[model samples]
Target: MSDKDVAEDRAANADMRSAFDTSAAGPRPPSEITGHYSSDNPDMVQFVDADGNRLETTEANAPYAQIVEDMTSQDAREIYRDLVLVRRIDAEGHALQRQGELGLWPSLLGQEAAQVGAGRALKPQDYAFPGYREHGVAWCKGVPPENLLGMYRGVNHGGWNSNENNFHLYTIVIGNQMLHATGYAMGVQTDGDVATGDPERDTAVMAFTGDGGTAQGDYNEALVFASVAAAPVVFFVQNNQWAISEPNEKQFTIPPYQRSRGFGIPGVLVDGNDPLATYAVSVAALDRARSGQGPTLIEAYTYRMGAHTTSDDPTKYRSDAEVEIWREKDPIKRMRGFMEERGHAEPDFFDEIDAEADEIAARIRHACQTMPDPPQEAMFDHIYAEPHPVTERERAEFVEYQESFVQEGAH
Candidate 1:
């Protein structure tokens, strides 16, 4: 055939197929049928709406719906309790920061549902690696609210034991936990703890980050590693619509959930403000991981209802009108409204919860004020599991420096 004829034929065909392609250009997987984000064709998996109404399930959410249906009234009431308690803890943390108790606080004011939902779905044996703002998850993982504050309070490196709750120390560097979680998940597979067919024996790992973390190189690298290893982990990205001051538009054109498919992982987006939706979806994803299905990425579509940290003034970048709009969709409010509407909880039950929250807040305030400052020598205490010459020298120097101060006073 003539070169010109061959070129013309290729141009006429216009269909380019990569030799590496295994998935034919036909029907997409059920996990991928939900397209990119759009209000008109919204595919966000949600069981409840902002108005406290239980939504009708669609094909995308039917599996998750069964998970939610399996939840009892008592189960819901416990979740509601968790939501209230965590919100209170978050409030106390913020208030303490403002009052000069904590060095800084990352307020999780609007994300109780997202954190609590994912937290509650975890099995005790499942390991989780969290970013700095996952206070709600910490609470769900049985980390004392005060324990979380110790790190942010500048009192300790991290107070809780990872082995105790299978929850790692908070990673302050954005998106770094993804790698750690992926590695641990790979270890779980090596240990033969995954896909054992025994529900209790099989374990999974979870890594949490915000919408902004998805933009980080580490996050992408972890996904590549997890995909190749078929790691039993879930990348829970809380898309609170903003990554610090940057909105979704500034972050990326494609949302995190939509992008997971690029890495050969299943992805789903859920109403982050709805705990029921978040919990249902989380359960499904965790089940998939335990069943040897590998990693799944879930984007919890929520919002940042407060400042990024004690140091940030969100008012500079976002409008009060927008904040107010999200305030109406508050997770606690909606969950409470839903309970009341269904008569799942009585008025006195809510009243008791509020009263208990007040007491907890007071106790937290007391704890903050009374928290002892660690001795200056403690900075050198835990640097190494075994004795190290460098750390010992540093400790000695610090002690000498402190003794010199005392000598000066005596003189």
Candidate 2:
């Protein structure tokens, strides 16, 4: 096309975008800015309450409760074990970064239940696309915790084979993974993987993002495409009260789950700190997709108990009072309390879990400290199918520069 033609097309796009602009509305005031954490939304699903009682399910949540009831005590115990270990992994990740063992770490300190519940719900054939803070999901999918350190430690892209576990490499760009998941789900649909009436053959995809991610165009576009194509996927949004430092008010007026309905799909809100609730809801959503019901949006109503990353300071935006309130609702603590009240575990079992967590944490620390660095040239290996002159030149220059440092030290 001629330059004039390209210029005209660009102008046309600019005009179309300008028509939908809403910048004149201005931002909401601080007082009017509300968070998902403040109110108790009665419609939210819960199989266990914050105070450790077996919660009475509401009409909206009764179906999920039935699913939870079908779960054996062993199942609950397994979830509890995951909740504890996941928390330990998160703590270790943070400590590793602080001790300069890793380059950076994104702590999933408060969302263990949200991740483990959804991660445990996946079938072997199902695929998962995760945002950066999905360490718990990685654990549930059988990814070694040390594998995750490679990424944060600046040693490699990702540590494990995604295909081995049906978990994709963590997407650092916000909301981009949703599109990847949607496209994969569409492929599954085209390949006759959904609604196949064979549990083993039927497949679903899961896309995970935080509440702030819902505001991205890629996220909305992925939902639109998935809904229209009847793609078998589930969008799991962990609403951890803040998007980095910005609160929910900066992202959207309604919760993400409620917004899913506008895209012609079902949505559900669950007590993200409640493992049984999250697991039941995720099972239902995955089932719906495998049965050709299209995508489901689940907003795991939870909190960010730590800084967004090791680089952030939560004190700049959120208050201690707020963090303390959510700390009381910690997934591991709540699950332990509920299990104790229900007599699902003995004191010895708790002791064993604590011991196990410590052992696992020790192994993770050792792995992070001793991981071998990738060869210097390894960075440029996958940039193109064949080597380019520019890449080869850079590689030579890097090697000479490193050797010069060694020679100077020898002198």
Candidate 3:
């Protein structure tokens, strides 16, 4: 209990702190390089490698390969078109945000194939519960690209009715859509719309979430419900390797897809950057769901090539070398390479696609500029399905306040 005893105790604590310091531990190996369990696992389904070469369909991919084999040259070209067009739309959105046209924008720059492939795999009867960055999926659901800009442009909360388009409004809360999708799938099963043996009559649901969302309590809870109910839903995790600034390694030790099996649902991992692989895997998963085989989890291994959102700065956390590595494995470029190699696409086809993308970008830019701003009173709209006195009162006050501004000759 003296100064000498205190000095010894302080010295011991300093040693313990130094032992736990990660900075003093020196640089740990990159997760992409050291922690890639997929590369070593032969069961991982991968149809194409980084350089765009087609790999043989192995046992790992056998279940999903049939759909890809049935795909025609025209189908391949169409996939490529969708991929390029979506990238253009995403790029344009990012530009709009930079130009101060939008409050914020989430770029799906590198994950286009993951969205497009899964989106194209759905039937008209199926429903999708999407996370906010699902612009590519929205494109496939027949939602106009401009519809997505409404929330960002401060026009509306969501621009479309989910029931009308079979795509739910984007859920900003991470992992919340997983629950919505599960509940919707349970409803579909209760309605007897599943396993009808008639493709047109059967229905399935897709729940889209990012790697980060997988860590949320809602995601796990949804999995429990879906497993017990045998719900016709697919939990699609786009493991873009980062949940904003937190890397996948920081989120969990096990791969996201692998975690699905613990919930009694089958899990499949695929190359998210490969459109063919993603499409094939999604088709198999969707088919299983429609057949009442219960839910499946698919983790699309991709990289977020841009900042998580306009408000983010990726350069602060990640190295440029890492980004450059992913750039070589660009999904759109890989698909284009595969198409050209198989003689399914020509130089002219790519040139035409470029022209189309350019036109689409121009249209989006014009539409964003022309979008009408919602009146301040409209902020209270859609807060409740039915009229509420509080919201009505707020709207009235907001309108009166605006009138007072005009009366005072305020700009």
Candidate 4:
């Protein structure tokens, strides 16, 4: 055969096979599915609108309102402070990733309220299992912002000890935390920690996952286990519309919260952008769990304002208009409005909070830049809690290898 004919045949075959080759194609964002962000879903529990107006408490929102009514001005201010500080920390982390100070960053920009609300709702005795983007939750649980950046910076697996704060280490494997959370709740049950009349003695577990994680078998299995075991657990699903580039529509037609009904667990959908509503819903769910009412599923309908991570380019899949729509519903802006309208704090208070947020962001940046790389032995040292022969031998060999090189090169 002629070289020209062979070249043409090869090109044709490549074109034909490319259509079926999933690896060759980049991610495709779902076509704009309108309604979740607006008033289209009648079931969504919302206390504040995009313009910061306080809505009348409806039958659907009564539970959330009852919880909010019990909150003090001081509590509201604290929630707002957490939201602002979390945003600042998220921004600093993103900047560090962009500047090559960190290996990667998964920004929790628009979902701050969803995390902070649930995080603040939990008592110190309650345990939390979180996915990678739960930085806001980590912050509320007493984890320093620098501690969150360590994994991304390649300095350590996770800087904080999970047991100390009752918050598990961030799980990179999607939906795995759901299973872990369920198992932990089961353990709590086996330990006779539930059904205690004393609120202080009763403990509940909150498992956090993103919309993308709902597709995992582990998540469904966790739901099944929680349902059958009647474990005191709350599945907090932050449905940010898009799972990375793929929209929630691609995952399922119905919202994730509604799926809980199939598992015989109650489901509640809340306005994730409004901290007040999120806090209210979270309190209700956690309270239910603590009261030994079994598990509850909470779907926080929020949006992802930034790219999935520093490595992703969201502009390729989603439109600018879609992002702009969600920007108006920003949790921080809405919280500030709620606080101002209620006269929760003066303008000076806000200024002081802003200063504090700035300091935190600055500290995060400095810490990321100055973080020391993990020593060569860290890999072996932390592998086995007690001494293991395998790890010990490997460590010795590594040390010997390095010493041999140094001795031979000595002048």
Candidate 5:
């Protein structure tokens, strides 16, 4: 054959081999593929609609449905309480910021269900690493509400002791908590605190972050470490649509949950607004971790109904229609509907909750106004576990400097 004829033959052979390659063969049977790409897939798992309607699903939605069905009457009530109380506190914090009582405040208005459900599912021994906005989780973990506010108010570096609350300080740098949480889980393993079939002694770590956090190097590294070490941790990503005006689509072509597959970990996507769904998935993941299973990634499909923080004005980049779409799926409202349907609570119960909410709002206002500013010396006191001569000398110098500046109207 001529040189050109030989090259053509080789190319033809390569094409033939590619067409009949059997290396990709599996046990699964092949079916006629029907391809359609539309956003209107009804098979998506949703236990509760935006209108507070209960939904049904088949085996396809079984995993998500499990989360929904796990919601009990008491769970519904408690979740509602958490949502209301946290929002009241959030509003007060925002007002305080406006009034110059606080340096900043990150509202948890739209994320109550995600925080409450996941927080409530944790065992007392399970440690939690939170991002800055997790006031709701802090509350559920029994950290005083003031403790969270104090940090934002610039009165303290971090208000509560992590050891006392089993809640770590709110990590401001995105995705840093993932490494910390993984390390803690590794410690749990080193101590052999994992369940050897003993439920009570088993422990896990839950780490929180946002959709934007998923793009960070630390976040990906944490997942790699957790998977390789089989660390008992759950990476809870609350994909509330917007990470400071950037939508989820801008960050990912596929959902965040799919990212877990690359790390050899199971990934789950739940309707984050559904308290029951959030609770169910979180509890199960924790249980699995306790049982020596590796880390799981949960992408809570929710929306950020409020600004990223008090400093952000989301209206500059997002539309009112977008916000309204999420408002319809409000987690608290869905739980209320479930509670009323089951007769777990009555209208009077809701009234009582409202009254309590008002009382909480009032208390927060009082606390914000009355919480004394920390003395300058207090900053030096907590810098180290033990005294340092250099710090002491600096503190004395600071005090002397202040005294020297005293107003001089002849005393």
Candidate 6:
């Protein structure tokens, strides 16, 4: 063939080859071409070192930390007290579940810092949306321990009224609360409860979820809604490293906090094991939201030191070595160390806290054991805002059935 003809023929052959190259074997591996977002980033914001030392930051980056430090000694003592009491209450709930007193109990053994820090950061008017695991957060929001235990004990759907405490009910469905929180925040915006430049009247919503929940469509949709609406909401994701047996690696190829970029919101990853760090990051995000800056995604890098719930056995899917590693970063221990190092607390104070914890534990155990089961009529009371005839009939039937069970000899 002539030179020009041969060049044209070669080009045609190349196009033909490209068109037919659909085989599994290719120039590049599929894995290499596929892009992924990370769910964990070690280099993200970390203000508290593992040694309990606080890292210095610019004046602008210091609001949350300054607030935490400015917490009165009484407030610090109250936080410690609340942490200990809630842990005991959590343990009791777990024990009750095992003893068949509860349907399930989600233990928050290692996440005290993330819960307490974020919980205490809220203003009184700020609303909170919590996953079922937010016993500590509920406690911080002034939810009585007995109220939380009552739910697990199957005595009530949820013990306390959400409106009463500015806290929503424990959402069992994963990631659902993110949408609720976003919707609530949108309402706040429309009502002009936020963006008024009045810190007191301005309101923000904080929604809590876990690493596993981050994989849910609701979580991502919530972010999209919040971002587009510029709603005053904080998406607080507690990355406790496991959604039951599945590790975080299975959920995301990259850190979750980075996912915020896709939705046009800032994402922050804090050391979840450090109470101070969690508080600082959460407070900042909430403040920003309250200031009408829109939503923020906070991935608190914590570890789930216990099973996903009382029924789950992490030993089947996770290693003892992994558990041991996270144990060293226990939130309570880190907080204690930080307090001691800074003279925020003393040995005597710790002793007092321990004694109080024991007392609280005893109280919770007694309360859980003695909590009365709801009357048969109670099941029908909150079924609807307005009374329903069908439900009333069913309620009557249930009450009759329960009454029929009473023996003639019974009082």
TM-score of each: 0.90, 0.88, 0.91, 0.90, 0.86, 0.85
C-alpha root-mean-square deviation, candidate 2: 8.4
Mind giving the per-residue lDDT tens digits that candidate 2 earns over 132-223? 99998999999899989888998886778899999999998999999999999999988999998999999999999998899999999999
TM-score of predicted structure 3: 0.91
Error of 6 at 377 (Å): 3.0
Best candidate, TM-score: 3
Candidate 2 is scored at a TM of 0.88
What is the Å distance of residue 119 in model 5 from its true position? 0.8
- Local accuracy of candidate 1 as per-residue lDDT tens digits, 36-143: 333223568877778778878787678788888888888888899999999999999998899888999999999999999999999999998999999999989999
- Score residue 360 of candidate 4 by CA lDDT: 88
State which candidate, 2 or 6, has the greater lDDT.
2
Report the CA-based lDDT of candidate 3 relative to the real structure: 0.88
Model 2 spans with C-alpha error above 4 angstroms:
1-40, 385-411
TM for candidate 6 is: 0.85
Q: Give the per-residue lDDT of model 5 (tens digit) for 1-411.
A: 799987975774564344334456441111100001111233233566665666666553576566566566777788888888887888888888888888888888888888888999899999999999888889899998877777887778688899998999999999999999999999999999997777778999999999988988899999999999999999999887677877554565455676587799998777678777678778888989999988999887677777888899988977776677667777878888877777878788899988998898887778767778888777789678899999999999998877766745335
The Cα error of candidate 3 at residue 258, in Å, is: 1.2
RMSD from true fold, candidate 6: 9.3
**Residue ranges of candidate 6 with Cα displaced over 4 Å:** 1-42, 56-75, 407-411
- Greater-lDDT candidate between 1 and 2: 2
Model 2 residue pairs with clashes: none
lDDT of each structure?
A: 0.86, 0.87, 0.88, 0.86, 0.79, 0.80
lDDT by residue (1-411, candidate 6, tens digit) is 699987975774564344334454633322221112121333345555566666676442454567666667677666677677777778878887898877888999988888998998899899999999999889889888888888878898787999988999999999999999999999999899987888789999999999999899999899999999999999988888788887655576545676687799988777777777777788888889989899999888787888999888888986777677677777677667667777777799988878877887788878888888777688788789998999989998988888877954485
10 residues in a row with least lDDT, candidate 6: 30-39
- Candidate 4 per-residue lDDT, tens place, 1-411, comes to 799987975774464344223353554332225444356566789898776678897877987787888889899889988998999999999988888888999999999999999999999999999999999999888988899888898898687889999999989998999999999999999888888878898999999999999999999999999999989999999998778878665676556776688798999988889888888888888888888899999998888899898889999888887788788888888888888888889999899989999998888888888888986777887786799999999999998887888899994
Deviating ranges (above 4 Å) for candidate 1: 1-40
The 10-residue segment with the lowest total lDDT in model 3: 16-25
Clashes of 3: 0
Q: Give the clashing residue pairs of candidate 4, or none.
A: none
